[model samples]
Target chain A: MKILVPVKQVPDTATQVKIGADPKGIDTAGITWIVSPYDEYALEEALRIKEKQGQGEVVAVTVGPERAKEALRSCLAMGADRALHLSDPAWENADSLTVARALAAVIKQEAPPLVLFGRQAIDDDMGAMPAQVADLLGWPCASWIMEETISEDGKSVRAGRQVEGALEIFTIPLPCVLSAQKGLNEPRYPTLKGIMGAKKKEIKDVKAADLGLAADGAQLLVVALEALPPRPPGRIIPGEPAEAVKELVRSLREDAKAI
Target chain B: MQIELSEEQQMIQALAREFAEKEVKPVAALLDAEARFPHETVKRMGELGLMGIAVPEAYGGSGADTVAYVLALEEIAKACASHAVIMSVNNSLYCDPVLKYGTDEQRKKFLAPFASGQQIGCFALTEPQAGSDATNQHTLAVRDGDGYVLNGRKVFVTNGREAAVALVFAQTDPAKAHRGISAFLIERGTPGFLVPKVEDKLGIRASDTAEFVFEECRVRAANRLGEEGMGFKIAMGTLDGGRIGIAAQALGIAAGAFDLSVAYAKERKSFGVPIAQHQMVQWMLADMATAIEAARLLIWRAAALKDAGRPFGPEASMAKLFASEMAMKATTDAIQVHGGYGYIKEYQVERYFRDAKITQIYEGTSQIQKLIIARHVLGAR
Candidate 1:
């Protein structure tokens, strides 16, 4: 029972995001790239499932350029048994659908009982891969999954999402797509033994051509991007306390329209 | 010469930084205020293979070199200096010597568990009389049948109260001076061993400084490290490596304080603008950055030398001397940058200021390092 996990690298949450000279991209200078936060939960859940079964492998796959190998390496260090890297230059500028095509190819080849993804790649917040890849693989998709239980024989899963103070539950058969949410489980840091041994673990190259795929799928086109303007300073509603309250209410209903 | 870190080193650094920032930093202030030893985190460190970073996996270690060890240590120190010293003492003072000098059998018992951080270990060399003159020994170990009966009072021993093993130095042949000293691995709760007192420290209070009393403590001959009368040499060799670790620690403390000062300067306003806009504050930050870089380079050179199997005693000494002094200066300037807010405990630069002071005094004092450098410079022993 192998659980396949697809991950994407994103700018560290702490880094200041600056729009690049190219409107479609971001400034890469001095940016510290990290495995996306929710994706960490996805990989962590895969590892947990393998450990719970006591006899299984957790395979990680990533679609990115050369630097994306570091992302796969991080997964391996966090106890993934093996990794597949779609590092062909063709994948570098691929849209979400094309990346999903590569992932679906790998998932089909691996034939894992389950495939997992972060709800969204934080870099772009697209959250498009799970549905796109599920359509490609002809599998049921469970998005924003918070809790899951595998049936005794591991043929199906009962998944749930927290919504409006209630659990929205669904039953999906094995060989399905599940996108992880924050409340799923806490991710563990890479242990010393894991890091030392990660180098010896396998990360096989996965060429785009080998997957019978071309980077041509574009369901959505991104236009020019601009930074959000800095917020203006708050204005003081002056006068006596009672008059100030009257003025604040008038401003909220009129100029601000916040009330 | 690729000055950039290798992938492995970066991984180690990231792991350590995460642990430090998420786990250690949150509790650092409470640990310092309470002066409680960080037992939980220390045990986890052992589990993480931090206690034996340089020790090989075959011997229950990370199988990393000194560079990785320093990188990890500096990260921990940047969050909390107490955790840094706890790690440094275990890695350089205890596990390191045992791995280097102990036989394969001794390594299995003495080095393995300590390196894995299952149990704490301490170095027992400093006595009340043997402060600067480490050779002046009052403790004595008399040869008895298959082992030696030891009697000694060792002071200022880090990790002493909690340690499972102690690497003790005593004069087996007093007439031979420093040459007469022999090192022994003594386990806690072995008949006559006692921890009489734990010291109240000025800084790094989360770590224990204890007084160890050995009364007719019988140690097995197999527990002895290296040849007889080789204790002083082993101690010196161990301190050389220990100094490099301390140098890295000092660098982290300074760097950590500098980081705080920078953030504070950017936020703290004076005369209707951020203090960072002032040239005086900028100059201070620039000086701290320059000093930290210098200290880091020195530590790296020494660590690289050690990894490449070269003599690095004088270089280690230089690193310790310069880095410790730099830490003191940087932390002080950090406090100044914070103004009255720095005086408060919540601001944390005061804690850094206190932690930085010990880096100048412990492992080997900055003055003693100067002596070692002078001796090396004159081509004299």
Candidate 2:
């Protein structure tokens, strides 16, 4: 099986996202970029599925500006067999559908048996790409997959997903899309040796035009991005354990009102 | 600066962290409290090629770079400082010197088994009276025709009680002083050698630092690491690499402490919100994060310089000095952040605090590192 992992480079989760002066995005300067947390899960799951099935190649595919190469390089360092960088300036402000369409066009050329993506981009919280890509490719799809097992002969995979207080399992055929969620096997960091080898591995690039792609099917356009409201300063009410518990319950009921 | 780790280093980092988190952390307190050598973990580390990370493949080692060694050591230290020290002495002190200065035959005989993890190795340099002043070695090695007769006592030797091979340093000629030192490879079964005592320490008890006596121990002349007077250079060189390992270990301890503190700050609510919301708490976390990053950068810089075959003694000393100090501050602050829970062993920050103190003491004291840096800066003899 040739597995494709669609990745996105986002500010590290440790970063405090700052609203850009342009009022449409987070300030990018000095912010460390990491492969999306969920994409890490997706890449790891794909690698595991490949390893378990005896033999297969895991390719990470990402559509972004030049700097997205860092994401691809990191995935390659973590033992991805190869990488495909879909270069396009048009992708910067493009909607989820545009990304899905671009990924679909590029992935079609490689023609892998399976494709994986994060359930959502934490920055945008738009969980639309995986379904859109599946639609474009006319393949079965599974979302929010937390657990997975591949069948014998590498013909199909069974995935377990959490859906609104219920667990849903899907046995996706060999050729399908999977959007990984939390609780997948823990992701592995690229080792020193892996990082060195990645430098030598061939990273192929494909233009959006070459892949017969454009932003025609954009489902959503981000406008007027806003920062999360500043959290209230903490107040420490020192007391005994029982008193502390009682005080906490009272505060939850009276102040936050969620209880 | 381009801060990319090699693929092998990345894998080693992941593997080391996984192995440490899963296997070592669970037993760390038990081993430290019992002061028992982690024989099983040591064997596992050997299986993973951690025992001889810098020893070339020709000597049955993993042939990894210095950065890879530090990365692995950091992970191990994050799990258990004792194991980290054992690993540091093996790869940086004992095996590395043999590979660098030993004759080809010496490398095969002395380095192979240790690198393969078939036998553990220890370095003996610190005498009862000397540590930072290693030149004051009181151990004596007398020329006896075809061999050298050794007699001396070395203290604070990590893995001393259990090691199968020891790179023993001694004053070969008292008249020549520091230049008179010589290194000899003493096999474990050598009749006259004995472990006189094991230290009861505040931390890293599981590693077994011991005092060893060489009472007329005899080794073949061919076992000498270099020329009779070259021991000082060899010892200093070994420490140049060893300091980097220690720095990495310190960084790991600090990082571990910082990580736990952050989690606690986010989850442990105080008055009306999680402690993380308090500006004071946030400032503490921010400082911890910044310190860790700075130390890591310095550590990596030293490793990179060493890998590039540049002069790194001053930088390595700086890294060790800065990182160890950073660890001390970070671990202490971590405890403060945890308040009552931090003082108790039930929370891991206390152990981190205990572990952090050693980084400032061993490999080289932070003060000694300052002297080294001063020497480099002032061109002091």
Candidate 3:
């Protein structure tokens, strides 16, 4: 079985965000990059499935600028057999639809048995790409898959997902798409040998224009961007243990109204 | 003593555990069975700034504190004890002494490679007759003109077969007894110094234990650590740092055993319900958890003291004694919880049980720890 995992590189969100001076985006300088947190889950699930089958290659695909090679290289280091880079300047400000269109063209060409992606990119926190790609591929798709198992005959896969406060298991046919959720499996780190090997693996880069995508389709568009509201100042309440607990409960119920 | 780890220390523990489980654990058993070092894992750890965790950044190390180093060793040891001991000896015995006492030239030449993991190191103090009686050294270092001629045999030297440099202890003044000892930097392949044999050990099988014979091994006087009569102090101080590493190793071994036992208890069934439902099994887990927490607190307290430049002699001894004993008991009980499956090698609890015994023996035996602690308590030598 051939598996393809689409990974995105985004600024590590856990780090303190340095808002751009313009207040519309993040400060890019010196910000570290990580494979989209959700995407790591996706890659891990794909690797797990490949290992269980004991056959086939787990390929990685990414749509980004040239600097994005670092994230792709990391995927290979983490045991992905091959990588495909869909490089296009148009992708810089492209919305989810255009990005999905570029990936769909590559998927059709590779014709992998399955496709996987993270639920969202931690940077944008959009949570839209997977479903968009699945729609573009015209295949059965499952999002937020917490557990997955392929059938003995390879005809179908069963996926468990969180829904409405419970886990709902679904069975989907082959040639499907899956968006990996957290708690699926732990992702492996790249070993020194794996890092060395990743440097040698071929990364095929094709222009979005070459995939018969229209130049206008590649046209970048950002309607507007704005900063989120700053979090309220923290308040610390100190008192006796029981009194503190009671006060905390009162604040949550009356002030925050979270209870 | 302050028993909590700083934020940096906690980060090191998390990072090391992530690296070991993801990069090292997959191959630990295979490498141990084949008696092969996991070179790739070690190299990767070096890249992650782990090998010389406690070494200062100025000397090609990560400059992390003692607690961080201890935490990192614990994670690595949980995956493979052999690699952990190698790391411990290099950081505590070889690189640390040079950084603490060496000339600028020596730090640049000898300390850099070991700290950066470009080369390995070993510590040679235990002669065949001087296992626990460390002061009774038979090795001799005689001044011959501008150099010192070293002649002796060092047995059970951890990492001896693979080390590029060895911090060797020899008697420089027999009349001074313990104060007579002096340390020398013996580079491997020095003329007249040879690795005669590597011992096959019951545990940490992947780590090479070898004997060295030094026959008229001439080293420049510049290589001596500190001054005459400083070897015993160097050896003891080195072991004080080493004890923390051993304590961390013990904690890791116990953790590995405890995790496996917990999983087994929740799944394995004897009388319809899961084995974890039994009261005795619950007691074992509760005791293990409580002991492990206490052990971690003590180990961290000692590490914090060392980092703070305080004398941690007593705390180090106490932590080592408690953690090693805890590991022995925990691994044995892990086997008991597994019942018959634990008796076999396939289940791996038996291996953990076997591995846990050595932590108590090496890095000062449990008896020696008691002596140190009691001496500290009574203000006696």
Top model by DockQ, which number?
Answer: 1
Candidate 1 CAPRI assessment class: medium
lDDT of 2 by residue, B1-381 (tens): 579986567667767887899889999988877889999988878866788886677788877788888888888888888889888888888898998899999999999989877788999999978898889989999999999999889999988998998888999998999999988888888989999899998887788888999999888899899999999889989999999999998998899889889999999999989999999999999999999999988998999898899999999999999999999999999999999999998887888888889999988899999999998999994
Q: Kindly report which residue stretches of model 3 are placed more than 4 angstroms away from their true locations once superposed.
A: A1-259, B1-7
lDDT of 3 by residue, B1-381 (tens): 344555345445666877878777777777777777667777767766677777876787777778888888888888878778888888887888888878898898889888888888889999999989999999999988888999999999988998999999999999999999999998988999999999877788778889999998999998897898899999999999899988988988898888889999999998999999999999999999899889988998899899999999899999999999999999999999999998887787776787789999998999999999999989996
Model 2, range A1-259, lDDT digits (tens) per residue? Answer: 8899999988877787788888977789998777888999999988887777668899998888888888898899787999988876767778777888888888788899888888987766778889999999999999998787778766788988889887798888878888988887788655444555677787888877788766464467667877678798998989999999899999999998979
- Where in model 2 is the C-alpha error above 4 Å? A49-54, A118-121, A144-152, A158-172, A214-217, A227-259, B1-87, B103-121, B129-152, B161-165, B170-180, B185-196, B213-224, B227-229, B244-361, B364-380
Chain B, candidate 1: TM-score: 0.99
Off by over 4 Å in 1: A215-217, A242-250, A257-259
Candidates ranked by DockQ: 1, 2, 3
DockQ (C-alpha based) per candidate is 0.77, 0.12, 0.05
**Tens digit of lDDT per residue, candidate 1, span A1-259?**
7999999988999989999889888889999999999999999999998889898999988888788889999999999999999888776667787788889998988999899898999988989999999999999999999999888989999999767888899999988999999989999988887898899999999897888877675666678778999999999877899999999899999998898
Show pairs that collide, candidate 3: none
Which candidate has the highest TM-score of all?
Answer: 1
- Candidates 1 and 3 compared: the better one by TM-score is 1
